[model samples]
Target: MKNTTISDLKIIQIDKIKEERGTLSVIEKDVVPFQLKRVYYLYDVPSDAYRGGHAHKELYQFLIPVSGSFDVILNDGYNTKTITLNKPDKGLLIVPGIWRELENFSSGSVCLVLASEVYDEDDYIRDFELFKTLKTT
Candidate 1:
């Protein structure tokens, strides 16, 4: 397999609509490169707590911090990059075959994730070494 880098990642701007009721941010299905299969959010994360210590083999995920802020550390078994997500209308697209970890979550941070696939244990590469191997070939 060819190596992937941070350059392959994308920052997607979610459309925000302001109304008398409240601000609305949306993740439209056709707006993204991939179709949405699963949607999950992380909330009530403590300052020291961390999430996402694995990489997906065939799944893609777009992460957005709907509230507060956090850093998404991405590694492709070669180079590493960190992208911060603090806005509800901004998303970080994490491609497959890239090792990712979410850290430095601020108080009351809510991270919303849009996935390309549903829950499948076999699609995940949880070990760093295995991810590295898979990233190379």
Candidate 2:
């Protein structure tokens, strides 16, 4: 297998249009670095909350704030970084083996996540200490 670094996480912005009626945004799979296999969105949630406490073994994901603003905290076991998703045109791409936590969601926030693979429990590393060890070794 190849080594995955923390710097691999990419931030990309989509194209959006605003009109009198409403706003429209488009997220293309080809434009992103990873090929998307699944897509999901989180809505009707509270603020200052936490989500996604696990790390994937072979799944890559891109997260975007479609409606409001939020912060995504990413931990590559050895290092950590916080990325703010406030624009519908912008997204953060997360590579595999990185633990991510979503928090500080603004009102009416909609978080859309595009994944490279389907759901698999074995792909997740929930323990932080074990995640660190895996990254080092």
Candidate 3:
């Protein structure tokens, strides 16, 4: 596997059009680095709770806080970094093999996720220790 670090994480700025009544955000397939094949989101999370404590072996994801804010903790099997997502126009790109955890969610925070592949249980690495070993292999 190529070296993937927190620095490799991309913050994508999707185009947003604001009008008098409401706002619209656009995500074009070609504009992003990957060809999106799936989409999901998380909302109504308790303020004190955390989410995403795993890594993927072959999937890529882009996350955005559509409503409030939350912190994304990224670990590349060695180093770790935390990034806060608050803007609807900004999306965080999570590459494969990086352990990720979402924490410090504000009340009513909505995390919208766009994925590069469909849901596959075999693609997920839910254990951090196992993920660390996979990175070195």
- Candidate with best TM-score: 3
| lDDT string, candidate 1, 4-122, tens digits | 67788999888999999999987666657898889999998888878999988788898888899999989988899988889888889888888898989999899988899999998
The count of backbone overlaps in candidate 1 is 0
Clashing residue pairs found in predicted model 1: none
Question: lDDT score, residue 2, model 1?
Answer: 36
* Candidate number with the higher lDDT (1 or 2): 1
Where is model 2 more than 4 Å wrong at Cα? Answer: 17-23
After TM-score superposition, the amount by which residue 127's alpha carbon in candidate 3 deviates from its true location, in angstroms, is 1.2
What TM-score does candidate 3 get on C-alpha atoms? 0.93
- Candidate 3 lDDT (Cα, 0 to 1): 0.88
Winner of 1 and 3 under lDDT? 3
- Model 2, position 111, has a per-residue lDDT of 96
Candidate 2 residue-wise lDDT at 89: 83
Candidate 2 residues 1-137, lDDT tens each?
12577788898777778899988877664767777789999987789677888888899898888889988888776678898899888889888878888989899999999999888888888887888788888
Instruction: Report the C-alpha displacement of residue 71, candidate 1, in angstroms.
Output: 0.6
lDDT (0 to 1) per candidate: 0.86, 0.83, 0.88
lDDT of 3 by residue, 1-137 (tens): 44677778899899999999899999885657888899889988888888999898878899989999999999998899999999999999998888999988898899999899999998888988888887888
Q: Which ten residues in a row have the lowest lDDT in candidate 2?
A: 1-10
Error of 2 at 51 (Å): 0.3
Can you list the residue pairs that collide in candidate 2? 13-89, 14-89
